[model samples]
Target: MARAGSVAPRQRASAAPESGQRPGRRLLPRSRILLVLALVAALGAAGFGAWALYGSQWLRIEKVSVAWESGSRRELTADQVLSEAAVPLGAPMASLDKDAIEDRLLAALPRLKSVRVVRAWPHGVGLKVTEREPSAQVPAPGGFAEVDEEGVRFAEIAEPLPSVPLLEPDMADAPSVRRFDEERTLREAVAVAAALPEPLAERTSVIRIASYDAITLELSDDRTVRWGSPEDSSAKAGALTILMKAAPDARHFDVSVPSAPAASGG
Candidate 1:
């Protein structure tokens, strides 16, 4: 209520800051949020690395066991094989070469027909081996040799071979020795052995394999069996069984031809 140009003293405002408004709030920019996220990610990675290096149990292979049906159990130990194989104990399971291990085992033990490796989780390995059993003994240059049905020579017998039937060749041209390089003759012998009758097969001492056309047998009694061809060998074997039963004292029985069999009496 003074002059028209005069100012009011009560209208002058105070100089204090506003309530709930921080002065340094503007310094926290978007880059600070990104920095915090990166720090959290680095800590998580470090924790995962620690677990993989020291805490995880999946990195170790604890046990190794082996089992076989034939041969000495102490001959093929899983620990020895695995040690020779050079596989790491704490290595990852996915990095193992199972097939390579099997091949190595086969190379180490030639008597095994097949070998299988099983990997158990967290820390175990199992090995199973299948061994070839000798079924027949054939006359060789040195002495009697043990062979499987495939005619593969495995061991040599000094004397008094097992009482199994001997297989002899009817013709001189037939191969008596089993060559390790050739598999054809061995496979054929296995086929022939499978075809022989159980009773006659048990008595057979040697199996003489010639060309596919001329197959023959030599009995344990120092007699000859003229087996003409491999075809219908089972039938021929059956016929031989009947003839041998009928004339047990016969010296030689020719069952090569089932339709017309010839026999020689003692």
Candidate 2:
């Protein structure tokens, strides 16, 4: 069987070392492939669950409940708040924007000092609101404007609050009032009121401000307390309390300088 020209063509092998997989086509181990598939399936399931919770009707909003945290008077009624909130009635609870709802409520009702809008699980949205309280009253166009503890004029009331004293600021004649700050006087007066002890504040009938430096309080009995400026208010308040108890008969008490306090008679 001596070969002729081809010499048996070098006896081609049937299962020669197959060229090791192509450059960009390496095959993964079977177990590794199975793990990859499991991971993909888990992600897909999570995605579907999210879609159902955020886009389906099973968890849609069925009710919006408004609750008051503080027992104070409500400037915005429950019905009014509901009407203003306009919470998407049929939207999925998970899709509802809690921050947007809170912003909307606050925008519609400035009387709401603080508000919390949250998903009350299953199918409801809950709102907890605290109404602004009137700390003092100032003369408005036709009635009186109520100022909250933060020195914000929140409402105009036809009748003055009996318990809350009136705040009078003499700014009409003082062009210099605008030189320092537009609301400096009113803010200072509110600070003074806030510094006073609750019992003393309740007894006070009026707070007068001639400037940021001149803050005075008139008691229910027509007695007076001269509280100058907002600086050292805590010290002034403490001094006033002790002075009042020490000289209950004094008609006028000056605590502008709490360290060297003074008391005078009519």
Q: What lDDT score is found at residue 55 in candidate 1? A: 69
The pairs that clash in candidate 2 are none
TM-score of 1: 0.57
Q: Model 2: which ten-residue window has the lowest total lDDT?
A: 15-24
Candidate 2, residue 82: Cα displacement in angstroms equals 1.8
Task: Output the number of the TM-score-best candidate.
Answer: 2
Per-residue error for 266 in candidate 1, Å, reads 5.4
Model 2, residue 82: what's the lDDT? 86
lDDT of 1: 0.66
